[model samples]
Target: MSSGRIQQALLAWYGDNARDLPWRRSRDPYRVWLSEVMLQQTRVETVLPYYERWLERLPTVAALAAADEETVLRLWQGLGYYRRARNLHRAARAIVEERGGRWPASAAEWRQLPGVGRYTAGAIASITRGEPAAVVDGNVKRVLARLFLIDEPVDDAATLRRLWLLAESLVPAAAPGDFNQALMELGARICRPRRPRCDLCPLRPDCRGRRAGVAESLPRRRRRRPIPHRQEVAALVVRGGRYLLGRRPPGLLGGLWEFPGGPVAEGESPPQALARALVERLGIEVDVGPRLAAVDHAYSHLKVTVALYRCRLTGGELRPAYHTAARWLRRRQLGDLPLPRVTRKLARHLAA
Candidate 1:
């Protein structure tokens, strides 16, 4: 079958089975852009609430542009990969300042905006402006790779170029947005990464990988290195019902708040590390006490084991050195401030 026939089949399936998501209900570029950003590296269910709340708070591009960075970051607290939030804010400001609140008309123009890559620009332009731009996110990549039975490493530059070309060819002129979305939906719900329900797929008739009985393995993946693990320490410094929290420097989990601490250096005990971190990060000395909790958290490439120690300030004034800011907040007030997941868990432990 030709690509045109496959596009029609997918569109028919989409019209009948497309998810009634909030973003799908509107053609507003701002809403579409917001949903796309929030959905990056995050599950739909996890992003739903954040998307709703963000739209409610920053209803328009102008509002988002006017909002402060801290407020935006706080709204995006639990949604990891904070760089997305920062870029969204930057893009909003650019739109407001550069275009006087008018969104870019085409995918190419959208790509010129901050953090608006090819996939994102295509999504926004097609979904909102009816442009015939193709999006090749992970879901779309998997779908096309299997449908065409491509076996090259999905991350290879040549493979990516070939997939993008395939996606562009499959995008129909009419309702290109729906065609693109349908492709993604089919991949997400039917042609899943594992245990794909080929029986329910609209494109099953044309799937080369299905005929070869290798649909699940068509998109070859590169081997990943083992994630390195590190030990760290945090000081649970409290005084008069307030706990001390410090803002991270402008890197990694930048602009977020967390308990003051640092890595457990070589040959150093947790308590010793906590004491050292307190002096180095906060410009104060603390006498480390008993262990409060040992929390394990994993990032995309790093696994950390943080030993939380109860500590008392023993010398020097509380001053911010390495951190952006430092504050002592009561238990109830901590909820209002943005905190990392581990810090929130520690807060709950303290409250209990």
Candidate 2:
């Protein structure tokens, strides 16, 4: 029940039960930091291959800093949340060029880097530098909420602050990193959000929510409003067996390649939308053809059903207005470019 007892139980459980992940094999700050960044808003299963591939490609901060944006985005193509990849690239440059390649040793110092929030900074600092920093990610918040029988919505500003303080208090002076990771591991594997295996949990004896018969319902989140849905269209304009791709400008889904298209206005058909988008964005006239595929994709704030259509460029030269660059890429060259997931879906359809 005491903080010392909790820490002891957690660290022991972690020592025995932790997964043999590649990043866990070393205390090297770069490896630790890179793993943490890649794992943000992503599952370990999803991140595993990407993590391995990333390390193989750009193993060091200097390597990442030296890599071009296209290369960085290519490695991170399917991982989504492209902003994370961009920020990681920027942070690497900052570390190499500005910080003289020295990794930040504390959570506060790590926070100064791009995309390194409090939770990420804490994980990096504690794991690699042995700083007594608390990490309050979704997993940690869930564990803490159930352990303490917290009834307030965990997403509430006040509730979040309290949870952070509680996590800070439980961090051990020795092996604080192990303690933080243990708590997260417990939440991830045992004290899960749904159907938590409380019997297997290290904190079962001390979990107040389990005792109160409400562990499943603790760590409540505020009701999320319905995400807006948009109907999008893309044109598959191929010439001489080469497909056209456009590079997005530096913003949402930035620095990534895509089949040029735009959102469908209220009553416009997919074909009409595709034609208008091509004219406005690329300054080329196109005759929209049959629909090739329709893919549904969701982002944090929006859901889109993208309809891919085969089209032929009819009139005018290819002059891109919204995109930074436009090119007709050969089939073999597609693998080297970084494309959005929806675009990849369309590409696969074309290949099929």
lDDT tens string, model 2, 44-91?
Answer: 999999999999999989999999999999999989889999999999
Quote each prediction's TM-score: 0.96, 0.96
* Number of colliding residue pairs in each model: 0, 0
Model 2: residues with Cα > 4 Å off, grouped in runs = none
The collision pairs in model 1 are none
Best candidate per lDDT, number? 2
Worst 10 residues of 1 by lDDT: 343-352
Pairs of residues at least 3 apart in sequence or in different chains that clash in candidate 2: none
**Cα lDDT listed for each candidate:** 0.89, 0.91
Please provide, for model 1 over 231-306, each residue's C-alpha lDDT reduced to its tens digit, 9 standing for 90 to 100.
9888889899788999998677888899999999899988888888888889988899989888888988899998
Candidate 1, lDDT over the whole model: 0.89
